[model samples]
Target: MNILFYNDSQDQLFHISPRQRRVALAVALIMAFLTLAALFFAGTKLPVMSAFFPVLGAWGVMGDVLTSFILFNQFRSSRIFPLLLLACTFLLTGILSLFYLLSLTGMLPLSGLFASGSQTAVWLWCFWHSCFPLGILLFMGSLHFNKKIIDRRLLPRYLFSGTTAVLLIGVLLLALATAGQDKLPVLIEDGNYRRLIETAVGPAIWALCALASVCSVFPYKKRGVLRVWLSVAVFAFLLGVTLSLAAGERYTLGWYGARIDSLIASTVVLLSIISEVNKLFVRLRRQHEELEESQQALESANEQLKELSGIDSLTRIANRRKFDEVLKQELNAPQRAKEHLSLLMIDIDFFKAYNDHYGHLGGDMVLRSVAPRLEAEALAHFGFTARYGGEEFAIILPGHSELEAEQIAELMLESVRSLAIPHQYSDVSDQITISIGGCTLRPGEKSNAHDFIGRADEALYRAKHEGRARFVFANSARDSCLHPFETTSH
Candidate 1:
């Protein structure tokens, strides 16, 4: 069933543990402590770094864009409005950071992609920093109103509006930084920003950040992994902004430390998303392997069922059904165009008389003993044996001539006589004996399987009337016959 919220098992953020919350808290405190140490050395000047601003700005741009993409993807699935707002903030941060890098004076050969002038980088940085926490505040506030599932039809509109708003804000900031620079307060001057900058604008941005943190903690009582990490990230950015504002000069320890904090803040959520994706992929691969094993086992069971259907339950060999199928197959086999095949019909003498004297149980025992002995002799001739009916058995011999069939029939008779099962009611002898009748014929266009079996039965009747222990023969192979379809290959 579809729930009110889009539940994703892969999204660890949806199910935060107490340990994770503690770890997140510890991380926030550590960054806070480190930033305070950097602030203590705020005015200490260091060697100038020509590539630091551009490289760090570029790194922040890539990280922010990736984080925005991950959050946006989640928003698309869940249709959660706050997630879209949060994603837009990241995208805005990335776009503005790029502009900030390009506007810097003599930092790199790359410049003028958007607005490049005095204080243009500073104003753009302010907008980027201030707008992000404002976005966070809105996100935390909106979570309260999102008790129902979002309508999927509104998804495209929400996505387009959120992204467009970020771009429009970026364009407005560019205008203020470039065209209306004279109207704005000076945030950066003489390659340093100390009392005037820190006292007015820095504290205001800090207050905005502090309010955003309060919204996350109080209104949103149910904490998720993403929200906790976002709070930690916002806290880090707050300290980084404080560090940058306190630094009296461009090449101070505070300036570099602030950039380090920015780097950590930008990559934290993105790394978590990557780890979540890796875990899901491993689980999917394991499920696929298990499904394949189940399918293989099912196929094996089906094959065994088919084999069982053709088997005789009583004799543990081919029954009448299997014998009929094999007889039909042997008749149609293409090798019959060159060679002959034989069929044998076997019957024990005085079987019913034996049953009347010793009871049906004793007759059943005699039949069971006689079947395997015939099968053993038939196997030597590359033939198969089946229980045809009561006290009667049949054997099929492929690629056997009339003379070879006759020889095998004699061996089958001898094999049964050797059993010496006592049959006191027998008219022939005290010992159990069997009668054999067989036929050998090559396949032809005119060959009839029923006629072949009838001829063998006729021979068996003659053997029964003429003394039971002997073998009788029917029609042998007629070489001069109609050619089979296999004789002419297309």
Candidate 2:
């Protein structure tokens, strides 16, 4: 199963499950309740914690850096613009956090490299919080604006120019906040000062960020994996902002809770990316198994086809084509001269008359019956057999002399007659009979397959002319009665 699938061509869409959307919604609801409670306690001050800002600032820098790097890697796979924006958004937040920490610690502007004051850290915090939601708002809305996939050739240009633009914007904002902190209205409500968020600016910023988060998780719309998680992230950031500046007081319960909300914002998207990686591994493993099974099935089919191509369908013996191929291979083999090769040809007697009387079906039965006996006797002598043509068969006896070849041929003659199948049309006997002719010769460098087969075929013609059922060897003549085993069934 494809566990998660992003629309690589579309900037802000993917296929997602109901469970994922439900989980995002759950986080939004839980955070919303907590944020409301924190706002209720916003005006109430708590014990001042000096380490709170430093701890949160360090975490924000590290967390946003990790989150941005992951999204940047994801953007490479899809070439989507929203992914790039999300990456840059995280990067901006991370850099702003770093500067805020450095300025607050009095570690920045080392050796007068830059300038900062007591208000620099608070303004940096304002810019960081403000840009994060704005970036996310653009990311979700760009779903309609950027529909086509960016070409690979144009990716570098987009990356460089886009990154350059964000960097410049961040630099200008840093300069405004740091070198000119006195001119701008202070955001932090320290001592007798008032918070900017508590006045007319409060409702506008909250409404806009809340709208962006709420729209992303619209119940009727399809919220994909990335969008769902990002929706959760933005809502968490909304909660942080709500808790931090709505009361305009430091060391309040909401002030501490805002840092926790910021952490949730960075973690949610990282969780989504991790889920994607795990599913990809599972998909690759399944594909590997399928590929192995397909390979085995193909190999098995090839073996069956190879066997079928060489086998005779009717008689269950090797076909004439297979016989020709085997003979040529053995004759031309490098080790052929080390032993003798024997070719024996057999023919049924008066087979035309038998078929004319019994019809072709009966004739087929006789041929099938005769083929097995020939094969059995040939195999007993360590020989190979094939059906040469209609009413004819051949055998090859490797490492056999003319005496061994003749003995095997004679045994085949007796075996066929012993079947006791009635012929009724043969001149030789009341039962079917066959003529055998064989030749045994050591294979030489110049040996040809046709010459070896023809020598045996010549002997078979002589055997048929001499008698209907008899054995003949090409090299010499022998009287059948002279052998100890003689059959008179034919």
Per-residue lDDT for 171-250 in model 2, tens only?
A: 88888887777788766545422456545455566677788777666643555677778788888988887777665666
Each model's lDDT comes to 0.76, 0.76
- Deviation of model 2 at 419, angstroms: 46
| Segments of candidate 1 deviating more than 4 angstroms | 1-12, 105-115, 195-199, 218-221, 293-490
1-490 per-residue lDDT for model 1 (tens digits): 1211325422235566687788888988898888888888987888889888678878888999999998888888876666787899889988887777777743423344343566777778788778878888777666666544469998888889989989998888887887777788887777665643655777788788777766655534455677667877787788878888778567789888888878777877787567656666888899989989988996896577448647666666678887887888788887888878898998889898989989988988988899989988898888989888888999999888887888788777767878878877777677898988887786553357798888888888877877677668875432111111112111
lDDT of 2 at 300: 97
Q: Point out the worst 10-residue segment of candidate 2 by lDDT.
A: 481-490
Write out the backbone clash pairs for model 1.
none
How many residue pairs clash in each candidate at the backbone level? 0, 0
- Which residue pairs does candidate 2 place in steric collision? none
| Candidate 2 deviant stretches above 4 angstroms | 1-14, 110-113, 189-193, 198-203, 218-220, 286-490
- CA RMSD of each candidate after superposition: 20.6, 20.5
